[model samples]
Target: MTDSQSNLIDRYQQYRTRRFLANESQTSSWLPGWRTQKRRRILVGALLAIFVAMLAVGVTCHFGVEWAPLLWLPVCLVFMPVWVALRVASGRQDDAPEAVLDEFEIDQRNGARSIGFAVMQSLGLIAAFYLIFGAVITNGDNGDMVYAGGIFTLMAVLIGGCTPAMILAWTRPDPDVDDLS
Candidate 1:
């Protein structure tokens, strides 16, 4: 091979070596600015609050809480997961590197962002469902188990919000020489 070609290959290899070392030496740090911690705290807090609220509603219903007030319970439950997912996904920076993509960096980024937006938008549809169900339950003067179900549903939505981050982090691409090629 020509000297110039050898030098080019050497430079490329050097770059790849540096990147690999950097990746290897770097600890898995959380996102900067306490955002990661804050997000975690909020997620936990939301879950705890939902649990407490559900318990209260359960006890009240078991005893004698008014059915009208209880109607909102389902709404809360149903909306929780959607809200959590929206909050988690939306709070992320648009340019944030969700996962490394040597071959299809743009495609992966675009897909992640698109998925993030879709999750966020679903919140509106969920909220609408909550409102509609809430209205119907209240209007009919019903106190059925549906309200409890709704509140639980919301909690599930909130829980679902945490998945994207976890999945993104878990599936993050590893450094490869070809990636730097």
Candidate 2:
């Protein structure tokens, strides 16, 4: 890459780091009650279920089920905000820059990232196989299978991207209560 391109990338990273740090303070207030381990785990479960539902709805819609498209609006709106809340509730540990995290936090984030990467790789392989074989099996006559494969690929990306935050939210302990003077 050229120097200008590298400089642009570095600038973007710095901007993102600043944004994440600014958002961290606001995150604690966004969902104060939901920061507990139990609630966070629940959020993680709901997110996973929603992802699966979205994938099913997407594939079903491609198969000519007219009603499936209607379900997308509510599910998608709910999915996006809840996913954001879950990330915030986890203190954005998975996305925080190393400089902003302690050694323990860094270790946890790296471990979760590793797991997320593995999941993405596995799901990515499945998506690739599905797309290639789908076209070959249909002799390119059926476009719906292609659409279905696209939906599957999108769902895989969403699931893979969210895995690390989900892991952090699910495993992190509740914060200790402070004593009042």
Best by TM-score: 2
- Candidate 1 global TM-score: 0.33
Q: Which residue window of length 10 is worst by lDDT in model 2?
A: 172-181
Q: What lDDT tens digits, residue by residue, belong to model 1 across residues 82-128? A: 34443343333223332323546546556655665566457546645
How far does residue 111 in candidate 2 sit from its true spot (Å)?
Answer: 0.9
Model 2 per-residue lDDT tens digits across residues 1-181: 9999999988988888888888876565777788889999999999988988888887786686767768777888889988988987788898898778899999999999989888888887887898898789889777667766767777778888899999999888887765100
Compute each candidate's TM-score over C-alphas.
Answer: 0.33, 0.85
Which prediction has the highest lDDT against the true structure? Answer: 2
Off by over 4 Å in 1: 1-103, 140-164, 174-181
